[model samples]
Target: MKDAWIPYATRAVPRYTSYPTAADFTPETGVAAAMAWSAATRADEAISAYLHIPFCDKLCWYCGCATSVPNGYRRVAEYVGLLLKEVSLRGRAMGPHGGIGHLHFGGGSPNILNPNDFLELMDALQRHFGLRTGAEIAVELDPRTMKPGQVPTFARAGVNRVSLGVQTLAEDVQHAINRIQPRDMVVALIEDLRGAGIDAVNMDLMYGLPYQTTQHVVEAARFAAEMGAARVSVFGYAHVPWFAKHQRAIDENALAGLHERFTQARVAAMTLEGAGYVAIGLDHYARADDTLAIAAREGRLHRNFQGYTDDPCETLIGMGATAISQFREGFSQNLKDRKAWGEAVTAGHLPAERGIALTPDDRLRARALETLMCRLEVDAAEICAEMDVPDDRLDGALDAARELERVGLCHVSGTVVTVPEEARIMLRTVAQCFDARSPAAAPQRHAKAV
Candidate 1:
């Protein structure tokens, strides 16, 4: 690790997945605002939708997502009913938008749903949302809990892409994080998924976990390569136990230090790039022929709640408890309380609890941030021209990048700023320069930059 980069690596920053980050959302803008945004969608436009399944059969101690083990399928079934209601409620609320072009099912392990319920949910999404033919439907999976027949059920339900959470193959490391699916378990699942024709498989891997090492990250990357995974997401485990209380279960002493974490991340990138996987901004790697790689090569990669993606829909509808919907006019998130969310949906109202409406300035900063995060470089003047604003609109951001330049995290030349390849792991720290809402969030509100 570069000694000069050490001090900056520990700085807390937003992931720039959405900016103004979810940190800036407020009660002042609630479901009413969400309805206004969704209600204005034009019929000619394509949109995306995300369904959040906030339940897992067993919780992974290192997980920072909003999820809990439901103890039994009864709770999950009830949630699915609520989700189905929400699907129709929000779908009918839209103004004949040109159907869902892309759909994502994220979780606490979307695979935890009973196969029948899963199919039933998909059917509702299709019936209410007019799911565009050939839409890219994706789901996040937890292999350990994946049922015997989910692959076929998912395929028949139009799931073309599936992401498996395969954090690590090291037994001791797995035990440390309290998620232990053996290597062969993942292999068998992959084979089953491919055999069922769901070949657009993505794998999620992580570094900086308890007892994790550089070689452990390499082993996982190599495993993804050997399995012909379409894309691999290598994340540096953000150990924010305060935010993710269950993370407190992780052994702090067993976690990798800043320098070691940096090394592990670098080695993982090296392994993936060497194995013919194209690095997709920040922590993702995609095969040369994968759509994500194609998007990156053509400068079309987009970052969203799911991280780097090729999905380019401007509006994304989010459903279920704690789900967040993104619109050009603003963003809204559903209530985190399942009971409250269900009650609201049952009452025929959008369950959005809080969110932020984007201002003109917010939109500009977000565009600038997305450009830098996706391309690793941004020209302030170029973005201003695209937004039809004065070139100086982002002058303050350029000045901020100059400070980061002094620290070796980024370079600011003229009106353009670029993160050096070696400093890419700290990309969020660089992107934070364009965030006007950073002052609204404390350091503890986000994870470490590295």
Candidate 2:
């Protein structure tokens, strides 16, 4: 049955993190738009914050992020200083928001920061944004490089959740990806984090890496379960060497075929489910008591640049180099180049380089795409009615959905488009039916639909 999903996996499609996707962002919509959106944020509206730390001790060959390995702690410390300055700049930009309900720290190993730096950064954020009473402070950690005092520092700073990047436990697999961390190291990190009162631990696992196999995938999944991970994200490695030059280090021949990749993913899913985890949207799974699982069950799941999330805030302010922020009106990105970002921030300017504003049509299509991506289905009439879109306006999308129906990717019964459970992995191709801009040209930038 898993092999049956092979043919459809060959099609390239966007992950649908956003309707138009990041490939469509242009320089014309820059810092001005971002500033306007930030200023317009209602005082009573809850906000989500994402802080990027773009430094790592070692560069993973398969990494597809805007990050680099710093030569020493001096560079990382320097970045933190700049980040503090940027936080103050952003705090002034937004001005007295109600409170921050969600704060996420992501990047090239956020755990690499010294304990003092991490706590200072948290204090700066808390002072500026006013952390809500029960806000969730989530940080992505690279367990391999976590310092001794980091966990306690996180707990002291009110960190509630920690996501560890444990891509795989096999020595050969880790070596191939140039991220060598053993299973014991990960277990120790989890234990330490748990001991420090951070009970919610999320582990990331990968299936489609070069030299990865079904056995390796299962092993990683079982290990995550054994370590009592509250949530697990299993992702297929998208080999886009052209986009991520470091990926070229991977041997093309060592990569699995589409069928094998599907099998590997299924094996991991089965292993996790057997260990009592409920599958969340797409590639995430959570324990029954986890907030993510509750979100999935209640149909309150959301798709963000970071993938599946339980955060319900309409606005997300992303700070630091290469961070992307989402506002009620649009999406904007900071400069990807570190030097340019630092220079712009130093000059008392937002470091935005590109962005896209949402038109009425864009917002409507975005709602529909997000619904499909989160729920694996969308009622075209229902959503259009809510958005007050005319029936004739969505004719092109209806036609596209009908065409997809013929391909067995979706079933359009009246106006409700549903992707069967078996075809859930290819749901992005189904949701792409609603995209109006360059749908034909989408393939050039998309990862695989499956």
Candidate 3:
């Protein structure tokens, strides 16, 4: 499977993080829909939030996030001020619902904010949407920029989990990607975070990077294990220069080919498993005792825009420029332009620019796709029954899977499609079969399956 899969490896597919993915969002559904949906949060539901900090001190060429290098702190301060207003606006729009169960700070680097600024934002979130008792607060950290005092400050604000961006440990690979952080920098930061009561340390590692080899991938995975990382996410670097222009800075010639990338992903998974970590879903590996691993084992695992998660919240308030919000009705995204986002927030309006309202068909297919992506298998018949649709509703997808099975992509036992372990890297390829959004017609919109 490893050597024979190269032809399909480079074929692009949506991450299936969301059904109808972001590519299907349209301007037809804008702020009014956002407002109506936001106000409809279930009274008994415990919601989640994603606060996007679109500022980073430095730009990493390999990064493909909605962020920029703010030359000065002035822009960041202004962004945060508006973000707080947006939070209040969102909270009020979502009147009288259960409190927050999961709060995530993601960005170019969420830790780019000063300690005081971080605290101020936390306070605003608490005031607006109270964090339910033991609610998970997770932050994505940049080890090189993390200050000594920020660790404890994060803990003080109830940040119990952190994910350090440790893409590669090899000096050459680090130089190639332009995200330089010594291994010791990450080690020290982890130790400090642990000392500050932030014990759920998740390390994000990457394969398929420029100048990266299987050895480089293995060393990073091993380092995550040695440093006691509770969760390690091994991501395949997606080089989408057309989408993320900074990627043009990387030397495309130096990037690993599909075969080599497949090898690196395999090696990284093997190394993490060798260290007693359980592979959760496609790329995440967690200690056997970690909540994420336990969730995967107990069938409580879920996938979101943030990848594999234990978060079961139905409503996610996305606050910031280019942030995408999730609700039972559908999805909405804040304005991608900072000036536009700020103006909307300042005018006391929902900042939603574009989105897609979920159709019943979309939701049914979404459940099937997420189930397959999370568990590597899905009984389409069972899903259709659960969604109150006909068992034959997904006959087209089963036929698609049959075509893939001829090429060894999946096994279709009646309506149950199963992706073999060897096909895990191409999980999206199998999952995309259920995507009703015409994924194959928009190949360049997403990354390669590998």
Candidate 2 lDDT, tens digit per residue, 1-450? 344445556767778887667888899999999889889888788899999998888899888877888988999999999999899899888844688999999998898899999989989998887899899999999988988888899999999999999988888888899998987888888888889999999999998888888898998999989888999998889888888898999988999887787778788888999999998767888999999989989989999988889888889999999899999889999999999999999999999999899899988888889998888888888888999988566667878988877768789888888888767667777777888875654454867864
Q: Extract clashing residue pairs from model 3.
A: none
Worst 10 residues of 1 by lDDT: 434-443
> Cα RMSDs of all predictions?
1.0, 1.6, 1.0
Model 2 Cα displacement at 348 (Å)? 0.3
How well is each residue in 1-450 modelled by candidate 1, as lDDT tens digits?
A: 678777677778888899888888999999789989989998889899999999998889989998999978999999999899999999888977889899999988899999999999888988898888889999999999988778899988989999999999999999998999999999999989999989999999999999998889989989999999999998889998878999999989998899899999999899989999998888899999999999999989999988998888889999999899999888899999889999999999999999998898998998899999999999999999999899999999998899989978898899999999998898988888898879324779888888
Q: What is candidate 3's lDDT per residue for 384-403, written digit by digit as tens?
A: 99999988999999999998
Ordered from best to worst lDDT, the candidate numbers read: 3, 1, 2
Which prediction has more favorable TM-score, 2 or 3?
3
Global Cα lDDT for candidate 1: 0.90
Which residues of candidate 3, in runs, are more than 4 Å off? 1-4
